[model samples]
Target: MPSNVPTFTDLLAGAKRSAVHLEMRDTYYSNPRFESWRQGHCVDWNDRASWWRPFHQEIADAVARGVTVRRARVVSEPVTEYIRWEHYVTHANVTAGEQVRWLPRRLASDLLLPGNDFWVFDDTSVEIHHFSGDGDSIEDEILSDPKLIELCASGFERIWERAIPHEQYEIH
Candidate 1:
């Protein structure tokens, strides 16, 4: 996280039409929440107060503003332990108004995807996330080049079309 680069909340708040995310990695080493889940911490879905957080509130707020927030994940199957943990907690994302989908890597073999994960905002700008080989997030680069934005935005839509909605997708 850098001072110059806008945070997710900032980007979402500024988004007018749509905010889409594409995640291709099966693991993220920097996430403490995943660590908690690995240690046996489970989200009590019945109790909203237990798992709800500011991030969800951001998505809810953005959706309330008519922003179509969607996330599509391209995972390898038999999924990694981290992907299983991600699946366990995806309800929060759905509850927050994000339309989530999953596409197995095997099913995406024919598609040309982006080299990095990204968030395309309003089809005008893109936030490309960079990660280390060990799955630790390194930095994010925001680009507004028309060609690059178009490429990423279109790439996301292609994956979205092939991905199964979270409600229907069963972890393998």
Candidate 2:
């Protein structure tokens, strides 16, 4: 990303309508949060202030403004350890005012999904994240192309429609 490129926080903070994220990876080790998850077994879901902090605070602020923040994940059955870890920590996401859902890969087979993970903000701008085979984020790029934005928005909705809400999905 260039110096002028806006951060994900900046994108969310600027959203005037809905902000949606689609995650396709089953394992992510690049986040240091995973380290804590690995050692502690779970995120401190009850410690609202200490646990979520500014990141969740940012999403809360957006929700306060009526920006419907949602995240949809597509994972395989017999979920990976990292995914189980994510399933456990996601309660914080719901508590912070974002809606989250999970789509089993088997259930999403026919959907024409994007090849990358992305965040589409306000149905306008899109940020695509590229990760290496090991699941480390190698690069991310922001796109203003109307076609790409529409594609991402539609793809997210397709997955969202098929996914089970966080409260309903059981980790495999």
Candidate 3:
């Protein structure tokens, strides 16, 4: 990404209307949180203090300011263990006021998707995330080109429309 581009934190902090994220990978083994979960560290749902992370706090703060936040995940059916854990702990996202949904990959077969995962802020900018085959983050690029932004924003909506809300989606 160019040095002039604002970080996702900055962009989200400044978002006035909406912010949306789309995650399509089923496994992100390199994520420390995922690794911890894989090693038996689980969120104590009864204890908010134990699992309230900064990322969740960011979303919460944004929501408090009236910035609508949404997230959609496109996953393969018979989900990977990482996705199962993510589903188990998604309540934090809900508590943070993000509207999250899940779309089975099979259902998204006909939809055109971006080459990378992304976050669209206020429909004006996109932060595209690149990852390796094993799901390790490689880099992020922020783009404000109208065409790219439109593609991501529209694609997110289509997936969101077909997705099952977090509360309604069951792990297969």
The numbered model that scores best in TM-score is: 1
Residue-level lDDT tens digits of model 2 in 86-150: 89888778888999999999999899999999999988899999999888888889999999999
Candidate 3 achieves a global lDDT of: 0.92
Native-to-model Cα distance after best TM-score fit, residue 102 in candidate 2, in Å: 0.3
Q: List the residue pairs that clash in candidate 2.
A: none
lDDT of 3 by residue, 54-141 (tens): 9999999999999999999999989999899889888999999999999999999999998789999998899999989998898988
The local distance difference test score of each candidate is 0.93, 0.90, 0.92
Model 2, residue 115: distance off in Å is 0.2
Query: Candidate 3: where is the Cα deviation over 4 Å?
Result: 1-3
- Runs off by more than 4 Å, candidate 2: 30-32, 40-42
- Model 2, residue 69: distance off in Å is 0.3
Candidate achieving higher lDDT, 2 or 3: 3
**Cα-based lDDT at residue 69, candidate 3:** 99
Arranged by TM-score, best first? 1, 3, 2
Model 1 pairs in collision: none
TM-score of each: 0.95, 0.94, 0.94
Model 1, range 22-136, lDDT digits (tens) per residue? 9999988747788888899888899999899999999999999999999999999999999999998999999999999999999999988889999999998899999999898
